[model samples]
Target: MLETYRGTYFHPRTQFITIDKTGKVIESDNILFPLKKGDEISSINPFFEGLASYFDSKEDNDIKFTCVHLESKKKQQHTCDIEFKTFANGQPSLVIIHDFSDHYEYYQEVAQSRNESVINSQILELQNKYLKEKEDFKNTFIANFSHELRNPLTGVTAFCSVLQKTDMSLEQQDYVEVIKSSGDHLKNMIGDILEMSKIEVGKLTIDEELFDFHKLIEMLAFTYTVKAKQKNIEFEVDFDDKIPKYIEGDKTRIKQVFENLLENAFKFTTTGKVTFTIKENQRRARKVNLNISVKDTGIGIPSEKLDIIFNSFTQLDVTQKYSGTGLGLSIVKGLVELMDGKITVESEENVGSIFKMNINFKYPINQENTSLENKLDIEYKNSLSKEKYNILLAEDSELAQMAVLKILSQEGHFYLDIISNGEDVIESVIHNEYDLILMDIRMPGTHGDELTKMIRSLPVQNCKTIPILALTANLYDDDKKRYKKMGMNDIIEKPFDETTLLSKIYKHLK
Candidate 1:
């Protein structure tokens, strides 16, 4: 191996030298060092004195060190690597000197830049890690905060809906309506804040599809009309027959705009009627202009402060009598602008307010997806009365449970097995053949999301394909997406309307 001739021997500039126990040079390669056979090792280079000192301290192993060697006779310098080896059996030790001047100069020139790059890379990694953690914290905070606020709200609202149906006096039922209304308001406030967050974070997206414009108006009008009638205020809805009933637009967001307008109208007014009007301006090419207006007999907005009202977290009502988060109009504005629409307000203080929005939408050529309620046959529904399905509802709130049970029972086509906790939910599902499962997100012992994933991973035949529906109040927009990703078949918000729940169940089972 020492006599191998395939490669250059000992690199660019290397010298071999032997130093005896007394430190006198016995052998010399004079190429890099020029000490003769009898001269002292330190005579060839000044750095040899330091290398000799280190060699004297260690009895075994070779030690290498870098130093600037000065040849006193020639007055020249070289950066060199000096390796000192101590021999066994009392033989002479060796010192190998290699000049590293070229490589050393190159390393010095680039070291600072390389070190700066390493530091910048470390900083970038930490920043990314911190951002990811912050995002995770935001998600967790939204989920937890929504759960805490909405659970009791759901219970109160659900029971109110159920109690309003009982054989109670007019005043008593009216009181129940108040409770339900308040609960719905609180839920809406939560939704407003969350929706505003979505807007600020740029996650809110519009869903454009063909839906019944008439049905949307009818639903909004019906809700507020009941609210108005409850308060002894007359309510009316007028639809322009010239307007198309089905169009391509974000139906849900459009509904939200009207909902906020109507809610604000109703909240500020103590007497008189709130009229909702819908009409179309004109149609040019594939675009249709929609003019939606909500006129309320409420204490109107001051024209001076109207500009700031649409700003986020801005409210003019300082008396604080009305319950609100002040995010509704901001959300409405964001959604309207997202759909390329504009809103204008007309107001007279203490008299009335009218909010109008004009938006253009793609007039859907195919209006196949009309309202299902419009096409439902009463006779066919009566015929399917005997077609009942078995369902398991896992909810912890007693009020919500009774309300849902009453609603489902009213359908007269469901056999419900209600459980209060997730453990009972899992145990019941393992034993019974249920057509569907209604799982609440918040429950004792196990969360509904965790249980859903668990059941899907379990080695059970029925668990593989059984439809599990989430009936939860903790459903922020992100939660809905997350639930779907976690294998949830479908989701419904808490304080569900009886008809909507029935329709969803019927559709899924069918």
Candidate 2:
């Protein structure tokens, strides 16, 4: 083959040898290492080494190799398929080299063109990913917004309706209470959402002031006691005397924290005891750390998912059957961090959960504050005075009517008449002398806005001027302005606080 091709050859196993077309072996042939020879075996062996290294690094085995030896070097260039054949016993037997240089050169030009196509494909993939995330975010935002708004709106609707429907069954009354409670919970959630947004944007400003922490705990325990009683669960609060009576912090925000923790504890514990323990640690001088804990005997979180509960939109239970925006813990974490505190939780499945948080701040002096009994008495007296005023309430939902009526009744107030639609509201107003009108915006007959405007147009002066407070689910500032323009005395967002409602009434009545 060496004489016919004008090239040198060598036996890989032994010495150099050349063969002719007559099958005569010429031994001691030129090894051809110094000069490049066409169809030389020595020149191609280096190409095999490069191809082996390239192929070994690739994840897939189906590949090709090509080599071009320039004509100036008087050498042959070739592309080849290097295949390792194995015997039946799985040992490599032979390597077959098949040349395909011309084909590889053609395909190499095609691959360069295909590079642009690959770049476009990657861009398209990224675009799709962003679009999917945007859609998901929109959906979550809508759901949260609707839930936050509807909860309070539903409460106002159901409570007003309950008062109108005189013949409610015992179960229906219980349903009314549940609706009110749910509305309250939703309102709190909305507040948390607003606070969370503020925190995320670094706009949540804290009002540092001196307040009684012991009184705060007592208030929390008292509020949760009623809820725990309904669930037939035992609730307890243990405070060490070493704990400061007063603390310098945002009292309202601190109360919110206590309420959230206690609420969470009571929510999960259907039958078992829930407890709050408070301790004062003066780890650093001039600043005392208030260590508080809430322990609940309920369905504890799974170990794996515990860490994620404090993350926004992460539900320890994704089913959402327990009623949450999954923002409760996230808000807690943010607030705790803002206060320069730390929070930790311990839980076991089916046993219970324990949450511990410490707030470090300057201690305020302990002083005599209004007793719980005195506050209740004053509230009761104020509510009793409100009972004399006839309230004309217009709402469409039976559930909302009931919830409001229950709240009013719970406050020991009785003078309120409920109507489901706005159609009869004018005539009702004309017939009865109302001290106040609790109006719902989205009613069946004539919507709240139109009704309020019509009532304002009536020449019957004093009754027309009677305070008309709007009860609505919409929390936008524009909605409040709209209600005011339509002759509403004030606006109360759905899931409004009972205390706030009464305060509005008192302000108008006085």
Candidate 3:
């Protein structure tokens, strides 16, 4: 066979040899390894050295091994597969060798590809973990910073409220008003940044509840009317009577949307008017689509920048005159989208800008004879009168405690005890029968949630059922839900005004 195929492509790379039962080569083909007729079969390669012993012990008919032969002069190697076969008597007889370099190279490529894929997968997983950790750190920093900021601003605004009532000259009052307004602005800016962080982390959520749409609009109108008077710009609210008065939606977020739009309108318009209009777009059974627009005859945005105006921290005005953190419109857009709504804008550089939003809400099932209006009126009236009630305030911050005391002092309706730590708070709740408990979320000894749980588990009925309002500087939607689940009746964010603080107190007191 070697003579017939001597010069063919397969002949030079293939070798044949005859071996004895003792694994000694009796006849040889030197095409592959330059072996002689009397050479030992194991002398070809180290791999075959073990193969000869394995075949001798196992009584195998054929054994295959991949072995390498090196050329010392060329400094190169050739890979080959060697098959040793025995005759019918089970005596090892012949060895056939074939070049396996091509197969070996193919397998090496496959192994290298698999190794690269494994490494890439590990790297991707590590990258994802790093990003998640970074995101978590960012969120924690934002929450802590917000808490630090809101605490001090609460003192500023609360003192501003106190100063506004004191006897002062016209100039002094004006100066206090400026300080109050600036403080309020700073508070809103902080709120915007915190809100944007929440949005980025996917923590912001829409909480839907039954609310009076007309009352919400009425409150906005009353508030903005005063703001309009201060800005010397005419403000108008055009309400569509066809829209339902009672609707189900996230009232706070909805109010924020309108407030932000109106705020932007009033901020840019110096010499002209700002108008907020709500019109009914379409009405299905129990579902109403409303078109809301805020138009301002102020310095409008350029057409080029209209697209990016809703981007976070994007400001059209480069001048230092106008004041904002540039997160208002972005927050407004985020809120609108979160409520399953859409908003658009039309603006020119000089004429004016109009922001239009469309949103849907469900009319409450039982709207007739609703007591919302009556309840609000009674709460306001009760807040005004000095009704004797016992109130316990748990606050760790001295400034916050002073602010609350000063604000509550105006009504003089409640006998108030302030506790700064959780141990004292628990003791107070256990011993004292109070109408309301204002629990601070972060305090020494025990956190507010755990303290509330401990109080609820007490034997006293008042301890379990008393109106426990969570006083927190970091009140996110998740925290609100958690507080509610942990037996907090309501939540009052820090830096609260006298009216808000008292209204909540009165509402829960009833």
Candidate 4:
């Protein structure tokens, strides 16, 4: 118990000091260590009682330790490699302390770096998960919204066509034409949006079936040429003589793609010629490339904006003079690419644009690819006008019911019985025989796939064997195949044209 020595033979920078067995600093080169010659050091070295037994005779030690340091009677944390020695009586004699404060600070810095890396990784993982959820939500919202919008628009289209056929003055006819045109445009826009949604979700696919390529071209040409001529423009359709008559492809999608191109062609052109040409590009073992070109002579595209034309929702006309969603060409490119095909365009500022697409098709196993001879010499006539049919419709929407009735009434030869639900459809078929069943895909009790499977399983001969046609607004190609697999003989999309409905009916009936 002494603070007597102040500067008596003690160095100022000395850190190593010696404490005796009684935990008293008997010697200190630095008197600033909070202890003089006889001051107690038990507060800093709390394990001084056990230090004698732990280091009986050890001269060197590598075990590191973290302990407290005393400077001017103030405590601070530090670490060190400690060495100890003992006297002949096995009592602790000396301790050599090595300060390790800098190494401890370095270890703390490394731990902080690891913590930051883990935090960054967690944030990145959460962001990716949120993006995926947002993508899925967008797809679902688009699909469901498109479906809900189709039902009411279908009623409008059907009744508008019905009103068009009535005896009206020229002024009234003009108003009805406006309604029909606007409704048709709206319906097409909805279809394009749904197609884009399907493409985004990777749900759009190609479902190939055997079809007549010539007939398809004829139908598309007639549809677009009529539209072109309505605007006082000349339209021409030509095909190479070497093109095949029967081929295998996704016929519906092919028709959609060409219609999109032709619609854009007619839209951009004013009084020039709109021409469509189909020629052979390549012929391999079973694959063939059909090169389709749509050339127009109206106001054309600029050189710099060619790349942006195919972008979704990108319209070149800044004034918004045209009436389209600008999604047609986008959908066209997507569908063509899905078919393993390519499309290119050439244009001038004030001249016109020529859009060319090369799509591949394969020969069906049912066909003999040996000859290019024309075996299909069939003619398509409007025979449904004179035929009578008993058609049964199973639909849930009231507007859809009225629309369907209006469409059938316009057809003039069908005795149609409308059922509000799946049960009635089954019971009606069980009690009475029907020619065709137009089954809706979404209803209160049951829907298309389930209802069709039910009818197919029924013991009644009429129910089991009747041709059931699916009526749905589902835009995915896989849904059509799913409906077919569920025992549907054909599918007629909602918001259909009168001629299309009648043609489908007659085709399935006869």
Q: Pick the candidate with the highest lDDT.
A: 3
Expressed as tens digits, the lDDT of each residue in 1-510 for candidate 3 is 876676564446787888776677878867777777677777766666666554444344677776554341245577777777765765557789887777888887999999999999999999999999998898889889999888888889988998899999999999999999999888887888899889778789988788889999999999999999998989999999878889989999999999999988998999889999999999888889999999999989888898899999898778878878889999999999998999999999889999999999988656776545456735555555446888999989898898889988887787889999888888888788898999999999899988888889999987777999988987777888889888999999887877778778888884
- Give residue 385's error in model 1 in angstroms: 7.4
Full-model lDDT for every candidate: 0.78, 0.68, 0.84, 0.77
**lDDT by residue for model 4 over 362-472, one digit each (tens)?**
975445553443332122235333466788888989988887888888757788898887766777877877878888898777777888898899898777678898888
Best by TM-score: 3
lDDT of 1 by residue, 1-510 (tens): 665753547454888888776688888878775677879887776566766564454367687887655463566666788788886556678888788778887887799789999999999999999997897677567656876776677667666766777799999987888887778777777777767767765677888887777778878877877888789898888788777778888888888888888888888889888888888899998788988888988988888987887888887889998868888888988999899999988889999989889999887654555443454434345545347888988888886788778888877788999998888777787788888888888889898988888878877787877888998866556777878877889887765766556666665664
List, residue by residue over 126-146, the lDDT tens digit for candidate 2. 999998688667544753575
Q: Residue 171 CA error for candidate 1 (Å)? A: 5.2
Model 2 residue 151 lDDT? 51
Quote the lDDT for 74 in model 4. 57
Candidate 1: minimum summed lDDT over ten consecutive residues — where?
A: 371-380
**Rank list by TM-score:** 3, 4, 1, 2
User: Where does model 3 exceed 4 Å of error?
Assistant: 1-98, 104-118, 214-241, 265-279, 291-307, 316-321, 344-356, 364-374, 377-387
Question: Residue 323 error for model 3, in Å?
Answer: 2.7
